[model samples]
Target chain A: MEKPQFDLQQAISRSIQDLYEQGTITNSDRHELQAHLEDSAEGLITTGLSEEEAFLIAQKRLGRPELLNEEYAKVNHNLRTDKTWALLLAGFAAISTFIALISYSGSIYYYLLERFGLSNYTWPVVAFLCLQSTLFLFIALKKREVSNFLRDQVEMNPLRSIVFSFTLLALVKGMQIAVLRYLPKSFSYPASTIYGFQGDKLIEFATYVSLFCLFVSLLSIFFSLRSPTKGTWRAAFEKPSIAFLMLFGIGTACFAASTRSLSGLLPVPMHFTLFGLVYLMGAALISYYNENSKLHLFFFGIFGFCAELGVGVVADIDRAQRGIGQIYTPFFILSLIVGLMAGWYMGNMLRGKDAIPSR
Target chain B: MKEISKELMASSLAPIILLILRRQESYGYEIIQEIERLSGKKLAVAEGTLYPILKKMEAKEWIAATWKTGSTGKERRYYALTQKGHIELDSQYEQWNFLHDLINTLWKSPNLTYNRL
Candidate 1:
């Protein structure tokens, strides 16, 4: 007797897959049905029927596809509206950009520039932030819907998502630089005085500008966290520990550079060394906690700043008594200790009751 | 054999499925075969139609499904009635018996008369 090879299962699988692709049934239900269809086909094959005949009989017995799909839809809710919130996001971006372009040429730009003593360059920065705040307000109003849309509607490949995020960050940074470069001659007082043109008014002006930049950066990061694609933003930063470390490192480097330029103390090399040390500490903390919560990052930033202010007051006193040249050693050591303690505490609090194992 | 009315069959489907599962745990294919065998070919449940009923019952927590290897060395999904399902089956049985008795009594009633004129 010649035996027949069956392609019945393949045909059954293809039909089931068609239903799956059409969103008529979910993966689990499809598998169940496929198995049932195969079993029925096999049972008929065992009764001396050819593979083709058995497959046809099995499929016919399964009944109509439309009826099956209707029933599956009731249970699975497989079909859903294909609306993307990206459209809303894109519209906001386009409108904001158009408004900024118009404002750059119109009276509003000149009004802001004259009223705040802002140059043509700096006024755009303010305008840009205003536009960003409008978008943030929109996001806040529709956060839940936006979040759902992001999860369900947005199908992004990893590479595309990464490229989009990096481009967004670079664009923001470029705008900041453009604003900084276009400042008027009066805005140059901070840099000149910090490098020893030596006027109290110049120092105050520089301090105010620096303070404004610091505030803007903090606000930028805070708003980025609230974005619907926060996961992508978080991933770009690597881990929370590194983000905290990098922020602290950059802040320290800036402080060190400005102070070095101000008082001619502790040359450029030492500032680099200090940054290197903070970065290493950040890398070490990465080994401790691979993941960080937003709350943990928030507390770490707050505590790091508080520690700096506390230590800075003491360092200032020491500088008055012992001279600026002698203050770097103790100040650097104290800040490092304070940052480490804060980092450790925040990481522990997030993990909840799993304190560092006692030696 | 007369084909069962879709309306009557639809109404009776859940109770019939529950009764089959009551005897033993079974998968979709097995349950369908058992129904056909028990009815002596009078009742035929379309394979596509049974899944929706199973899904509904599972959602209501009247049944639970598990995957196990069948005799052919392939995995098959089996379904068994839950405690709630058993209670429901008992209730359905009582309701069906009452309806059956009522219909029988009405058919045999002395007052039941029809004028051909």
Candidate 2:
């Protein structure tokens, strides 16, 4: 007689959630509205109306969810702006945390592997890529759930997500350092000095850092499965990027500054890890953001991904081509024209709701 | 019964709500039902529009709400008029009466010409 039935309660709760997403109502407002509906339905039931009839009438009086959202949105003009800042912050935190873990962790792992007389990195790379693909698959399959969760975190508390991510990255980062004293070293990590890295050490450091960042990112997204976070390497692991030029600008800076600190890093070649990262990141962004996908975007994604992988391979051909545009330049800037159509298909497949709209 | 325009309902809701709260503390459902009964079911205020307005009036300190356990052991938010609300009701009453009288006068004498500044 007092509490509404579960079905009725759930319906009202959805309406309340819609209002919440609009940023207009608090939990107490939700309670007040729910109480009103329950009371109305209870009274109607007492008057010989069926339970469903009573629920419908109560819902009608409460107003439609769309209209309610609009009315609620009237008060919070900052709602969308706040959400954008939160998204960018979370994205930045995830990307940086991955970079840091990579800078240091691989060297630590390589030492452990060599001590055991195991020289293969093939298993780890395969395992890492598979885990990454699973994550991309999860985003596709759980698209509805993840998007809702994303909205809840981004809307409620953006900064908390950043703090939450840092904690996880820190945990993974901590694991590598704790093992450092026990492992045999083929290379020295500057840890503090930027000049500690050179030649083979730099290649090793950059390679592992790139590889580990990709691995951690996959792990991070996987953990993000249960989490609100994503995964990390570097002694320069100590510190930690943009839209278009901004991404390039930061990538160039990291390429130059971390050059020495990165000396002698990963067991797996750098190209493999970077290829995985580009595919996953591009896929994640495309699938998550694009609402109504045109099939052309799918083909475009494949083209773009291939070109991106091609560019990295082209650059690895230019380890001697180490500076800013130098990597992309020697690789033939044609790769850029070529990559525009690649990688985004996996994104479209992961779009979840409307994967491809057939005209 | 005549269907009241939402504009009139919106303007009149505050004074009516202030009066209802003055008589006794009541929750949203009861206050709305009371308004419907008083107006012979001619008015139907939306819960959507009503709550936000309640929030504004609550902010103005013309009303205060407290949670109480209703008969069925469920919590209900009951609202009461405050000192400022009595003043607001009086103000609204005067404003409405003046407008009411002016309209009555105009309707009674539709052809009168007046000076313009």
Model 2 misplacement above 4 A: A1-6, A77-301, A304-359, B66-69, B109-117
lDDT by residue (tens digit), candidate 2, A103-128: 55656545433454333454554456
- The residue-level lDDT of candidate 1 at A286 comes to 37
Q: In model 2 chain A, which range of ten residues has the least summed lDDT?
A: A232-241
Best by DockQ: 1
Q: What is the DockQ of candidate 2?
A: 0.48
> Candidate 2's interface RMSD, please?
1.6
lDDT of 1 at A85: 39
Q: lDDT of all the models against the reference?
A: 0.59, 0.59
Instruction: Provide DockQ values for all models, in the order shown.
Output: 0.55, 0.48
Q: What lDDT does candidate 2 reach at residue A46?
A: 92
Among all candidates shown, the one with the greatest lDDT? 1
lDDT of 1 by residue, A35-109 (tens): 988889989999999889988988888988888888787887633322223434433443454343332322333
Residue A64, candidate 1: alpha-carbon lDDT: 84
